[model samples]
Target: MIKCIAIDDEFLALEIIENYVSKCPFLELAGTFSSPLEALPLLNECGCDLLLLDINMPEVNGMDFLSAIPNPPLVVLTTAYPQFALAGFEAGVVDYLVKPFSFERFLKAIQKAQSRLAPRPAGGTGYLFVRSAHRMIRVDLDDILMLEGKKDYVAVHTQTQVIDTLTTLTAFQDKLPVKDFVRVHRSFIVALNKINTIERNVIYMGDKKVPVGEMFREDLLRRIG
Candidate 1:
């Protein structure tokens, strides 16, 4: 596995990278940090093979962070700004992914990392465990249709059952495969393959209609498209 560390001030961005890392069997998540300064210790340790560094951050910027390290690992810079792409490439980044990037795009970056680091092996299973009724329940990735968020719980909707898990939506979302599952709304996350169709801004899944949040509409569309 090509071990990797991610640094992003945005908690949501870190969450997205964490989820993406989970999907790639060849990529191992070594660590994640909210601040670039906090990551200096780990970077100095040289335990990772790749760095998913965000460009816009406090304490120190991505370019500065790159410059601080001697013999840095393969880097895939993530940012909202396109202007930094040239600088990132000039500074020797493996790839550059703009904000709200797709899993397919992330894979391209990983491909570059693998070319320089290690060859990818086989993949993993299609299931994950979730805490429900004080017990961990095994939910198959293929069985999951949608996830509905409650106050302090998540309704795990599968083809045969709807298991009520004791966890926040964001927490549950972290456990899912980033490529297949998407948080369309604050209260809902749906499997891309399970979506029957989309009418207007809502997603159609058999008898259910999931409302897409304005913030996540573009991402949802990109995933389905």
Candidate 2:
């Protein structure tokens, strides 16, 4: 089961999350907090698999709370504001749920979080075989520098060269190891080791500069720093 916690200042929101958790056999509700602050102690004391967080909160917001935590669990933003979606994504939130979301939408977001947190085999090389242009390509985790979106295709930037193929960013993103690679922009994903420096909204990989989206800036800073 995927252990999780729900943090929302509104009692009604918490109740809805609780009810949803009960219906999903794969999800185990560990706790529910009306205040993000109260949830911090439990998070520090015991590691959780998933966090359903709220963006707007008194004292500290979900984004700030996540920033304070050293190594946060997979987070799914639950907020009334849709504008915060990009910001939440940049903060490494596994998913985003606008308030008054249906159970179906909620389930989809949690499933994504679960996929991200799923356990990998010991000593695994973390390689993925992707079919590009009817040809199978084996990608090594360490060699990738970044990925960029080109229309409907994604350009896989590696240490040696760039490879372009028809694939959605999300499709390729799901195949990558969460710890080693990060989606720093809607159009880009960079390998952690390849990042030489971060200056404002740009990430430098050697001499190449990758633009960091506004919403992703905070998350990239946290990852690189």
Candidate 3:
């Protein structure tokens, strides 16, 4: 079961989420909090695997609160404002639920969280399976040299070959371990250890060169340096 906590300043909102959590067989409602501040102590004490958080709260809003926590659990942001969706994803939230959302929509979000937390092959293996042409292909994380996004698909550049899959670059970025990979541009996510050299605003990964955007340059330099 996925242990979870619901935090919403609105009492009715929390009640709806709590009821929804009870209906899901795979979910266990650990606690419900109407106050974001009070929820902090309970979060550490109870220990949860998922968090149902409200993005707009008094004093400490959900987005900032999630950011402050180190290695936060899978989160689903609940907000009336749609503008916060992008920021929520950037903060690593698994999904976003606009207020007054249906149970069906809520269930779909939880399903995504389940897939994300699903157990991989045991034994310290650093690899993930990506779907391609109705078949699942195992790609070793260490073999990845860089990732290039092309519209709807992303090309995973490995040392020997490129694996093209029908997935967004942001999706791959979220799954990749942050300590080993960094997004250097809107269309490029590069492996820190596989970088051959950085000249100007370009990253050379073997024979391929990926351009680095100005916004992501500082972080990329800090990670490599």
| CA RMSD per model (angstroms) | 13.5, 3.6, 4.8
| lDDT of candidate 2 over 1-225, digit per residue (tens) | 899999999999999999999999999899999888899888989879899999899868888888777778888899999998766665667788998999999999987877677665578756666667888788777778898988889988877877888887766776676777888888899888888888878888998999988866766677767
Candidate 3, residues 1-225: lDDT per residue as tens digits?
Answer: 899989998999988998898899899998898766888887767678889999788879887788666446778999899999877665557789998999999998888778667664568648889888798989998888888899889988888878889998868876776667787887888888888899999888778889988856766776766
Q: With candidate 2 superimposed using the best TM-score fit, by how many Å does residue 153's alpha carbon deviate from the native?
A: 5.4
C-alpha positional error of residue 203 in candidate 3 after TM-score superposition, expressed in Å: 11
Write the residue-wise lDDT of candidate 1 on 136-193 in tens digits.
8888788999999888888999989989987767556545655577778878989898
Which pairs clash in the backbone of model 3?
none
Candidate 2 lands at a TM-score of 0.75
The positional error of residue 213 in candidate 3, measured at the CA in angstroms, is: 11
- Please provide TM-scores, in order, for all candidate models, with all chains considered together: 0.52, 0.75, 0.70
Count of backbone clashes, every candidate in sequence: 0, 0, 0
Candidate 1 Cα outliers beyond 4 Å, as residue runs: 119-225
Ranking by TM-score: 2, 3, 1
In TM-score terms, candidate 1 sits at 0.52
